[model samples]
Target: MNDSSVGQAGKAATVSARISPAGGLDILSRNEVARLRDVSGSGLHGLLRRCALAVLTSGNISDDPGSMFELFPDFDIQVLQQDRGIKIELTHAPAQAFVDGQIIRGINELLMAVMRDIVYVSTQLEQGGFDLDDSVGITHAVFEILRNARTLRPHVDPNLVVCWGGHSISREEYDYTKAVGYQLGLRGMDICTGCGPGAMKGPMKGATIAHAKQRRRNNRYIGITEPGIIAAESPNPIVNQLVIMPDIEKRLEAFVRMGHGIIVFPGGVGTAEEILYLLGILLHPDNAGIPFPLIFTGPKQSAAYFEQIDRFLRLTLGDEVAQHYQIVVDDPAMVARAMVRGIDKVRNHRLDNKDAFFFNWALNIPLAFQQPFRPTHSAMRELSIRHGRPRHELAADLRRAFSGIVAGNVKDEGVRAIREGGPFDIDGDKDIMQALDALLQAFVVQHRMKLPGGTAYEPCYRVRAG
Candidate 1:
């Protein structure tokens, strides 16, 4: 890594250009800009700086948010107020985010998106305009966030495939994701992901090739990330459409709401969290009959990995949970074929019900699945992953447990928690805990936890799934 202090990260040439909002953020009040600039520790300035740096350093290929901070410790972004519109100014921005001393057009647009959502969310949070306490209200918040970003396109079909997988993945597994995406793209499917590296980038990379072959114009590579995750996983260049949700909960909600189907690639805790979230919702009686397609696939060598995951799910959630997703190994062709057929079902169901194609409005997600889960020390301890309760509720707590681990593993706050409190203690049903322990150990052994070339992996939690 090049060692440049924030003092010399980028060439110092100030450019002032007025840009209008493409979709939602054309105008903002002076009061809003002042609040965003409220850099007084409690304000949004510092958080905004971190997220903007992540976008500026898109395709940086590093999972460590600290590294980016270290490289550009002096970096800062400010919203310039004007009568007609807004102007974004960057100080000591990452040199790569710009070309020829001018910020890339895509990056510029993405940076504005950051400003738009952050401002809107901050306004809502302070004003109490969003009833985040209620489940339906929380879902509405998610929808409004996406709508404000102009992400939901009307009159479109169910073609967006949300691919969930690890940023740290095996080369073989990554290749498999590309191949699967290639097949999906050839069939006129678009790609959506957490929008980072590894599996996230692979499908988009593959689809670009297939999209070109089909001469598909105006194809979308959508990347949805929250402020917490964007730091660790910057948006890959292939993401033409980028939306940064306010938090992880909304980000997950946006995924299920926007995509037609979901494809799971090899991943770590974050991927596991996604699986649990989807399973929790799908297992709900309301969502049982919904024809949503969920699949878990990897290269032949990854059979053992998926086997471990499947075992854990069956033990914890029940064997019936297997009814929600398919296990396809070593067959990208089969993976793509299954998703195509699955989406066809989604289309037929949506058509029969007169639902929107661009977004799945019919999937019934409970409020527990919609509320933002802040992983504090007490929150981690309160998670009830025991047996005998409703299956969907258990899945929600289980999802939060994994999410806490993910936050600790990569997200800044979770990392800070680990540094102060050691690893989070996860206690639950004995058999389920054992299954989760084995699955997590396998992930560590496979180097699926963190970006390579760093310190050795450490267990972030004690799993007592007895």
Candidate 2:
């Protein structure tokens, strides 16, 4: 293995080593390697470096992507082509990923995943393997990405529960998430989460123990994230399988399509965005009678939080929307029991319809939900969050509204946009806007918007109720 000394920042030691891919990602063509090495404006080098750094610093909590760059200013990664295989060379890499001069096995696996996804997405998706414009095309692309990552397994019973919640959560809420995960794990259910910290980590952590007790081997803790958010929320160490989707919309679609059920804990705008996205799709007439179970859950103290969310959903989407999900509070056992029952129904439904258990091919996701929403000022302002529209359409707009807030809060480009153009302006129906504003204010007041003890979070959007 070739090694060279790279300069380091003050007191932060770095390492340089050539390491082989740990997770069956050894083969790479010359063109693929060139794309990864290319540092030009159109190349994938910068994206690869940023994502690699995120993988190296897994479990280290810091929401600021810029800060990570500053901390490891000299860090570099290169994909070296060899006659036998490919070798990943790291320069000034994070020392924490190494223990006693060897990289941790889990981190190495994740690093390979990062490289695998980056190379695959650049070559396959961007270079015409899939058309990303049409709705069906996008879905096919999503399926292809997941399939390439080996995420979809056939003949598996429907037990993957997608856990949605904020990375910034209270200690009690975090524990509650673990409790729910423990219950789920005890029932042989696997987990799929956005896979950062707090709620994301808690469930996987709890499930690990329960899986151990049950002697459940090869239990999947799947983490799906995108490039825009990966830097802000680094993957937790608990993520056994990680797939980085091309964008947030695809990531959300992956969650709903892959998991049999979804359980939402208290979260900020991002979680709200996820909730709206799923509810919007479920509300579609085409999706009616689908057995995709969704549950809103939290600890006893978080009852008010779910109450507010429920009230907002009812007010905006009508009471009928409640049928799509059930709210469970302070009852981990009940959550798991409900999930098991739900999964049984999902299994029966999929069998009756002859659908695949690993992927939901029957769910009809509208084109609006598939297309990426750029959270520019004008785009945010033009969202039609009025009650006069169809409930699903209204939910779609509201989801975009919250998505904009989430982008402004954590995404690098959105933060830069806010710094350049001030907060995004969101104008909509009077009652809906008032409810939206109140919910956001509560998120801020409860320290849900940003990680606790970080700098005070300024509003990223101005709500103008018509």
What C-alpha lDDT do the candidate models reach, one value each? Answer: 0.85, 0.91
Clash tally for model 2: 0
Query: Per-prediction RMSD in angstroms?
Result: 3.4, 1.4
- Summarize candidate 1's per-residue lDDT along 430-450 as a digit string, tens digits: 878887888888888888885
Clashing pairs in 1: 429-466, 430-465, 430-466, 431-466, 433-465, 434-465
Tens digits of lDDT, candidate 2, 1-466:
3344544654577777778788778899998999999999989999999999999999877767777778888889999999999988998888888876677888889999988888888888667998988989999989999999999999788889999998888999999999999999999999999989989999998899999999999899999999999998899999989999999999999998899999999999999999999999999999999898899999999999999999999999999999999999999999999999999999999899999999999999999999999989989999998878988899999999999998898898899899999999999889988999999999999988864247888998999987
| Off by more than 4 A, model 2 | 1-7, 451-453
**Backbone clash count, each prediction separately:** 6, 0
The total of clashing pairs for model 1 equals: 6
**Residue 183, model 2: Cα distance from true site in angstroms:** 0.9
170 in model 1: Cα distance from truth in Å? 1.7
